[model samples]
Target: MMMITTGRMLRCVSLVSMVIFAVLVNECSSQHTVWDPVHASIKNDIAQGVELNAWCKSKNTDFGHHRIAYGDEFVWTFKINFWNTTLYWCKMWWTDVDGKYTEGSYAIYKAERDWDECQNECHYSVRRDGIYQNNYASDVSDLVYPWPK
Candidate 1:
């Protein structure tokens, strides 16, 4: 009778330990699966044709220099999985009809709790006069570059 009771106690202890381990694992794994969507829209208004390029980056990772055309709109979506109080940015550059180049960018610093408040979409309009229609909260004065200049 003593041996049977000892065996039952060990089994119960093992079961409880397994349950605790499972809960810890679940919590850790769920944190990494939390991701938010970011949308970007670029509209080109430069005449005589132009090459529009844009990209997004977080930490040490970056995406691309996606190319679009004059009078065209390009839309992109990104799934951001990590945030260390670092800002995520999307930058744009273009070569205009006269071979002049212009650039602009937008960035957002999103906190974990603000994930649901993330901007569903951001719009940027690239024009020969300069970058226009910026929707970012940051100051974009540095992004303006008149094509003739």
Candidate 2:
């Protein structure tokens, strides 16, 4: 029969205590660790010679208005907020080939909805019908918003 001596028990308790303390310290420090930045790209997929006007912003940052030519794209990168509440949205408009004006507003990224799906990168293709979205983690694209007729 193996009996634990008082000294042996004390040493084991000390080792366990040290491991718990180390784990706690690591958990606390991770809250302040810098997060990797997320990239967003918006591409124009309208008809040839058509230009898409886009203005995008977050609560604290605004990317000035841009005119994106067909086949061109506008891109930006930003780090997620410490609170994990980061969000970005855009207002877009363009004149169709028939001279009809179309416009829309959309939330391009919401941390709660995109954190798992986007996994750090988001892509948008603005088409004559709507906006299509693709993410870093998947090749599949989905139309998330449509232009207002």
- Find the candidate with the highest lDDT and give its number: 2
Q: Write the per-residue lDDT of candidate 2 for residues 1-149, one digit (tens) a residue.
A: 99999999999999999999998897786533227788889999988989999999999999999999999999999888888898999999999888999998989888778766666677889998999988545678788888776
What C-alpha lDDT does candidate 2 achieve relative to the native structure?
0.86
Candidate 1 lDDT, tens digit per residue, 40-68? 56677767467778776666657677777
Give per-residue lDDT, candidate 2, residue 76: 94
The per-model lDDT (C-alpha) reads 0.60, 0.86
TM-score, predicted candidate 2 vs. hidden true structure: 0.75
Clashes of each: 0, 0
Cα lDDT for residue 133, candidate 2 = 84
Candidate 1: worst-modelled 10 consecutive residues by lDDT:
139-148
